[model samples]
Target: MFPLFAARWDRSDLTASLTLFTGLMALAFCLVHLFVGQLRFLDRNPRSRWLSFSGGVAVAYVFLHMLPELGANAGAFHRATGLDEVMAESAVYLLALFGVAAFYGTERALKRSRGQDKDQIEQARPESSVFWLHIAVSSLLMFVIGYLLNHREDTSLIGLALYFFAMILHFVTADFGTRGDHPELYDDRGRWILSAATLAGWLLGTQLSVPEIAIGGLFAFVSGAIVLVVLKEELPEERKSFFLPFAGGTLLYAALVLSEQALSA
Candidate 1:
């Protein structure tokens, strides 16, 4: 028999291991933002199948895992916030709606600032103030994701692994999308700031603990934002995205996630 495997687990050892693992995952996220633009294969004009596949994986994660978890956490939100029954039931979802609307509005603002004409919009960079505003919003989102890595609803090893994988693919798509919008600004300044924001969030998570309701709210908002980002990237006409890889990635990750839930159940 394996004595160590049968031995009782120590709480301190488990905590230390989790901390080390999540910290490494956080670093991986930072690296992805910093270098994703350099992935020339994904920079194809016709849109790479890999890019579509990554979007599929991200979308699958949001719809399959995060949204359902938000519903399950509704009671926690009610108890923590002391809201009315109706408000408690709808609060998380309302927050999700707000997230989607906010990002959509920001995109519209950036486009309008570029110019009214399509050709002018394509060639002109967003105004300096607009570009910085976009970066600010994106950095805030990156911070939320990094903080959640340490304080996820499911802190089990497998849960963290699933979250990390989904978010990495999501980041690839997000970074690429931003680069398409502001190639020079994103490369010179935006990526570095976003990368730093993620690390800063991880650093804060190590130092602070918040109410579970607040964490759940952040998670829900992120889920909504992710849906918008994925759809916007994959649905555009010019991207010429492939459908087969997208569907394949979706089915593959969905099966894995559902199987994990069943085993844990």
Candidate 2:
């Protein structure tokens, strides 16, 4: 199905059918991660690692094997078409927003069945620095995979697969590290806004070919800063457990960004 789409449409010197497919898969992976994370899959440190590994493998397989072949044949099959990058990005953003809304709806339905309290939804259980470390490592992997996919004109299918695999792993790690107490208040509007913003950021990063480090760093900084601010208002007993992942994610994002900047310089 993807190949047929590639054969019919996509024509950038660099954008092959495989590349498009992989890119779409990457977006799908992100959405899945977001959904699962929201559902509290990474509540435990060990489980986070497993999820990260599984996600990474899934992403890597698509990038390494699927992308390269499509890229190599990109020119022979399709002619360059001046499709709007902005429009495409917008579409992805919209998709992400929709996904979040759908997830929230599902969650609400589940809560009704379980008789969960509207104001006291259980937050993500806390984990050790080990979990944070895993997240940091996975983020680094995302940087590498993004870089490789963006820079290479012609990559092997195997290589693309590995890259995507690493990316999913990275997401799992981040998801694990940042598991927080589910908010007591279900703010549908707030969730929708955040989802839209996240999707926009994601689309911009991919469309602009922003360095992976920069993108990751920005995510880390923003998410960490939000967490830290939230902690300031929490009870003393609640502060300790939540801080590590926020700090770790922030540090990792900063490190990756600085490292990349330095190397570029």
Candidate 3:
């Protein structure tokens, strides 16, 4: 939790400013969905092609852009921290894997608890008082995501835009998922906690600057979580995913990412 506040934004750096602006806007867009969840047409279309497209775009970002960037960051981590080269590389990848597993584990636990609560209420058992626990845990995870987005400086406006597009959809699905599990809690307190936590994380991340290695590693961790959460939404057995739209989104955004990298190269 070292402060990264010293690296003040240079007003001349328009690209950074614009990217930062878009990042803020994207967070606002997600926050809006928490209130307007059911009002959207997409909510009715759970299997909407847009979901698959967004999932695909998200998948492409992690695999093509985030992973490669993390590989380089791992190398930097090795140099900056003076870790063993092989071990640093291994650790970096492991962090990504760990992110995926951690998110999956959390989601599973939450879903199970939600189910038990529902069942207990049905049986007329005392209503589960674990609503605050869910709000806390989900808020923490989302806070990390917002913080990591602030750390993603390597991305250009276009890349961030695509990322923003994907995550907006990602949050929408997350809202629906949570609502499905605990309708009352999500309606009353859960969404507010998430919005506050995420916005707070972004504000904190912007104000505090950490070491390069920490930034790189944190970004890698978020990448892993992104992959996990996106795939969970799109690749479940019960959910019907539109394959063509999915692939179309995957290829289109993958090409966009690769092309940008190529141009910058």
What lDDT score belongs to each candidate, Candidate 1 first? 0.82, 0.38, 0.68
lDDT of 3 by residue, 92-117 (tens): 88878877777777676665654566
Clashing pairs in 1: none
Candidate 1: misplaced stretches above 4 Å?
A: 1-14
TM-score of 1: 0.91
For every model shown, what is its TM-score relative to the native structure?
0.91, 0.34, 0.80
For candidate 1, which ten residues in a row score worst on lDDT? 3-12
**Which regions of candidate 2 are displaced past 4 Å?**
1-12, 38-41, 44-149, 152-154, 181-265
Model 1, residue 237: displacement in angstroms?
Answer: 1.8
Supply the global lDDT for candidate 1. Answer: 0.82
Residue 246 shift from truth in candidate 1, angstroms: 1.0
Model 1, span 1-265: residue lDDT tens: 4332233323323466667888999899988888988798997778899999998898899888888888877888889889876787699898888778877877788889888987577667788788788888889889998887777767666667778888999899888888778888888999999999999998887777788788878888887788888888899886799999899889988998887676566
| lDDT measured at residue 233 in model 2 versus the true structure, 0 to 100 | 22
Off by over 4 Å in 3: 1-23, 114-134
The superposed Cα distance between candidate 1 and the true structure at residue 52, in angstroms, equals 0.3
RMSD of candidate 2 to the true fold? 15.2
Better of 1 and 2 by lDDT: 1
Better of 1 and 3 by TM-score: 1
